[model samples]
Target: MQQTYQTLNALTNFYGAMTAAESARRGYIFLGSSQDLQRYYNAKADMRSQLQILQKQIHPDESQEKRLVSLNLLVNQRLSLLEQSIELYQKDKTALLIQNNITVSSVQIREKILKVIADIKAEEQTYLQDSLEQSKQSIYFRVFIEIFTTFLILIIILGLCMILENQWIKRERIRDLESSLAQEKKIGDLKIQLFSMISHEFRTPLSIILLSAQLLKESLENLVDRQQLKNIFRIQSSAKIMNHILTDILILTRAEAGQLDFKLQVINLENFCLNLVEDLQLFATTANMLRFQKIGSIFKANIDERLLYSILSNLLLNAIKYSNNETEIYLILKSEADMITFQVIDQGIGIPLAEQHKIYEPFYRCQNVENIAGTGLGLAVVKKCIELHQGEIIVESKVGTGTTFTIMIPQENT
Candidate 1:
């Protein structure tokens, strides 16, 4: 009974702390007082304390333990959202804007938290009711029931034997399934490890080959034969394409393992876009086929250049690959106070409207692209990179017309 009381108290205290933190956050945002900031910090501490207490109190209840995992996540998200609101307000005096944006999210998270708490309380109450009812039963009544149950059990022995035999067969099948699943997991792990190793092994040589091809092409600058020069350039282009493939493979493997590395660097947006376009255009072996443009005031940004490069390069290469040699592909860049947007537009073989959803899937090609030479990993790689940036991608396309990919990623003002 005392433990039950403690568990309920902890649950209520956790809720109270969250509410206090939210109130303090709003108070600080509106009033900008140090006292409110201090209150917020205190409330944060109390919430953690309550969470720990609840963890201990409900440790024995398996169902409650699972509920606690979700509860923990909700509380963390709420706290982070509240804390971020305060931080953003401090940085930009964005009280009204931030509050308005988070109002719906805040309400939804709180409602979910309340629902989970009520469920936990209901479970505990039912359990307590059952305990109380059992306590009220007389000992003689229980003995009578037990003796009656034993007689019934004797009469149902043959039925029990049959049920046990069926249960044994089910257990055997379950064991086989478990074994098969274990084997599959082992094979999958090996495949990932082997792929990582092979990508690393081949990427190094492919990079060296590209470098050598570049150097060889330069060294043979004095050669008058156009055919040799063209062959050398082909070697360089093929090596570049191969290097890009291995890179995508490595990235996909790392992303699957949840270890994609992200590091931000200051980059000139205009120069980056221009350089990327120029490089990919050379690889496309086309004359002035790609167009680049920029919008908005900001030109410099702190961003993960590697991931950004992957996202843009894949989209650009795909644009070049899918579009006709005579058609123009556009790379549009826009920067704002709070976010950056990229638009990759291609006026070539457009994706079928019905097949757009499957494009982001790795190695998935459109039915119309059957005659095209591609591994279909480009858009999938782009999708992974966009996710790592915590961004969103939208696609608009029509069969036999064209396609446009718009990506928006959030970042603070430079």
Candidate 2:
């Protein structure tokens, strides 16, 4: 009974210390005072020490062990929440210092930290109430055992032991579930890292192959027959296509890993779209059938050049690949006051309405276009790039008619 009382007191003290630390952190955020921030850190350290002591002293009998475990789990959860809150607060503070402004994102982070702290305080209060009730129950059980006959006491103790065992089993199952979730998250992170590494490694060799193909085409231009010239061009085109695919894979992997960097530059919309269309014509089966139209006045916009190129190139390649050889593929650029829109319209096999949503998923290929050779990553890359630019992509398609992908990106200023 004495040890149980001591354990409960330790838990209470720990909770109090944690609450103080949270208060200090909140003060630091609002007051922006170094003294308050230092006090917050010191209080957190003291809370950590108190937690360690509480964990060491929490030794309960078999009948009370399940309650102890539940208390410990709650305390650990509170500690975890505190740590997360601290990290987010630090990040928000650093952002404020660097930018010299309090952005909406920073304010949101502060609100999230406050919510986490509130949850911790609420859990602590609930645990304290439960502990008080358990203490009262223990007192009653002890008094009853003292007055009861030996046989009756034994039966009562056995019943209590069974109840504790069941509770322990339930707690173990909950712990196992938590462990499984953590392991799954770790596996997902590892998969993304592996993808990023492999995609990066492929770039060096792909670049070499593309360069070799280009050199071979140049070296054999004079000596090669018409058939040989065609083969050389094919080799170059294939290598270029392979390189582009690898680039898309790398970009997607980076984006997934949150490492994609965007460098914005001013570019003329009309010339940019026209040049990309003309350059892609070299790879088009019906080169003469490719067309470009300017639907609005030419204007300059700030955009990431490389990402924009990938978006346009991928869409154009899909337009050419899915359409008939003789059909026209159109690249239309339209600039408005507040937004710029690029439309890739192809007069070929259109996407099915049912599968349109899945088209942007990584490595997803349309069932009707399965016969066509493709990595099925083009549209996925296009969609990701558009999202990075804070843009929207609208698909208009009919099963037999054609598909039109319209991308509208908001300008920096209206």
For each candidate, what is the lDDT?
0.78, 0.69
Give me the displacement of residue 241 in model 1, in angstroms. 0.6
- Residue-level lDDT of model 2, residues 90-162, one tens digit each, is 6775544433222333344445434543444344444444554555455445433432433353366458657
Angstrom error of the Cα, residue 152, model 1: value is 74
The lDDT, on a scale of 0 to 1, for candidate 2 is 0.69
Question: What is the RMSD of candidate 1?
Answer: 26.9
Candidate 2: worst-modelled 10 consecutive residues by lDDT: 98-107
TM-scores vs. true structure, each candidate: 0.54, 0.53
Off by over 4 Å in 1: 1-192, 225-228
Model 1, 1-414: lDDT tens digits are: 557667878888988888888878877888798988999999999999998998888737788888889988998888778877887887888558667787568778989999989888777655554544454344335434543553464357437546755765565565677776675555446546765666666666566656555444433444447666897677677768867887887788677666678888878788799889988977674768889999997876878898999999999888888887778899999988788899999888898888898999888999998677888888888888889878999999987788999999888764
Clash count of each predicted structure: 0, 0
